[model samples]
Target: MKDMVELSRRELIKIITILNLGTTLEWYDFIIASTAAAIVWPQVFFPSSNPASALLLSFTVFALGFVARPVGSILFGHFGDKLGRKTSLIWTLLTMALGSLGVGLTPSYIQIGILAPILLTIFRLLQGLGIGGEWGGAATMATEFVSNKRYRGFWVSWIQQGLQFGVILANIVFYALLGLMPRLEFFEFGWRIAFYVAFVIAVIAAIIRYKIAETPLFTKLSSEGQVLRVPFIEMMRRDWKRVLIMTGIFLQASAGFYIAISFSEAYIAKFLGFSDSFAVQTVILGAIATIFGTMLASFLSDLIGSRRKIMIISPVGVILFSIPFFLLLNSKDPVLVTLAVIGYYFIELFGWSVMPTFYAEWMPTQYRYTATAFAINLATPLSGGLAPIIMASILQTFRGNYLIAWPYLALVSIAYGIISAISVALARSDTAAKKIE
Candidate 1:
């Protein structure tokens, strides 16, 4: 393995770009599923006597992907930690593309009856598996390859941006299609086109990902016979507390994000009585804020010499802003609602931006891929996966009164804030002790 000194600045930039592109495609598919579940799928795949029941069913299937993610983390995490990042990433991309294409091409429930939704569930599970492993591999590859420790946060921030960019692209595509076609037409055929586009994006991402070299850290570990035979088990035995702490920290961010992106759109359009176009526009604006906020937070984390500060502050921001966000949505005015969406996302994305670097820096290289994947993916089902379902259930229970949902989200954010502060403090103490040794 060549030292970091051997890798050029240009090479590092290329690696970051390639890995970011792969995740961009991965999240593009995700946003498509999320968008569909919120709007299109209820009408098409899960048609029922009750409208609320249909939406809940769609969200349930959406959460099923989260249920499968931990399995993906363990399965691909093994190969990722034991084999190579590049190889694992290429396969994850392929699986994601295939799953998306399958969803795009499947017949509607009206045409195929029960078979249609069954197939959709299967494909979504495949996507869950693909993305489960993709994040850790891409994050590890980008962070470990960088020679300068100071700029590591900045580079990993680009990977986070991929998710925001994917949301942007997905919203833009939906916005354009909705603008071009009538509502009936969009529901009939236009939605499928988004998935087809995801497949193409995945192919491009896979090609770029395939061209990148393995990280120097992984190479060094493998060469020195330091790679764990079972990275997930080793992580469990040695770093379970770290894993639990990371998962707890991640849960708040994941739940807050889904509530902002996934649940808000449905709440605005259906419960708040806004148009579908207005809802899509709100999400697009929020995605833009998220991109800007992520970059700003990443840059500031480096400048301030602590990702912990950003992590701790983010959930508190979410908790404080939760009421205003719902109040703006309740206004039913497009402008205020837009402000609400963007304002919450700007703060929420700060935690998202710092997570890649935090996870990468904390875990040892031998089990970094498995540990990071397990921590994040395990949290996904608990927090991100259930957030929309929980919100939807709350709405259902209250007979569509959104006022109750706000407090639930606020409490979750507050818990995340407290846990994150404690975790960050402990991590810093551990780092200081290691340095003293």
Candidate 2:
């Protein structure tokens, strides 16, 4: 083993900025689409005789994006591992940008008949494909850039911060639009502005990404002729168990986040009698809490020198608090709802904050991007993608019974948490801090 090249403070900041921007840009587009699905898309693209049916249809489209993620993950992860993270990242950002642009330019169902929903679905899938590749490369870049292995958690947490920031931006933009325009006007045209803004963010992130250099580890591997011809196949053959374990570990974060941020919006608006703006506001607050909480959790992981411990602890806390979170939401008191939102977001970060570095540490440099992306993306479709649809189906099945619906969602989260905790506990992987090869 040789010493990893140390980046200067300036260079490290530049790298973090580039990765953070790309992550934020990708997620902004993704989350904006999700927010619209909850509030705006039902009327614009998937209008129906029954409002519930329309909402469900819209959520189906929303879930389709997640379904496309694993495909994106495989496609991008292969290139990320075989080529260079920098190049793969730049392309992913552009793909997401184009998807957002398409969504923005797409006409409403009133104008285009069935073609409107179909175009929306296509654009959303493109966004998913772009995001699938974006996260793993960003995480790999962030983790591999930092010189001190011990602080990788704190450093890579910034990339996760971009996830929260993206949520915040999405909610804030939607909230502002809700306030600025009447409900009809907002639904008609204001929503497109958010997607348009997403395109600009992607373009800016891409330009910034082009200026940054590739991770030193990947560069070293490439220089030494260690790049695999087929990184995904190689990883599956050797690290299949670890991959499965990681998928389980990621389940809670995937399901928990979408449920918290997206499904909860629909629940609050439709069943609880809150305004869409109110739901977006709560999510904005939750995202902010996640940003702060994840930062703290990442720092603690580095301080305690154990990423797995936080991962285990975080899910247990989320499980215990799951009922309380919904209870608070059901209370219908704005203060309690906000508190519940923030609290759930805060507790979950104990696992998510450390996830990037934790996943990166488990894989060798030659294929880290593919393995991490594949694991996370696999969980996305199974958990994140299904989360909103499942919750919506539950509520619909019960004819919009709040009491049954809330508890049921909480129980589902508990199940996901248990699976995540048990998987991490049982898995055999290198969780210790180590220099990247």
Could you say which candidate leads in lDDT? 2
lDDT of 1 by residue, 308-337 (tens): 777777767776777777778788788899
- Cα lDDT tens digits for candidate 2, 132-189: 9999889988888884656778888999889988998888999999999998888888
Q: Which pairs of residues clash in candidate 1, taking residues 3 or more apart in a chain or in different chains?
A: none
Q: What is the Cα root-mean-square deviation between model 2 and the actual structure?
A: 1.7
RMSD of 1: 2.3
Best by TM-score: 2
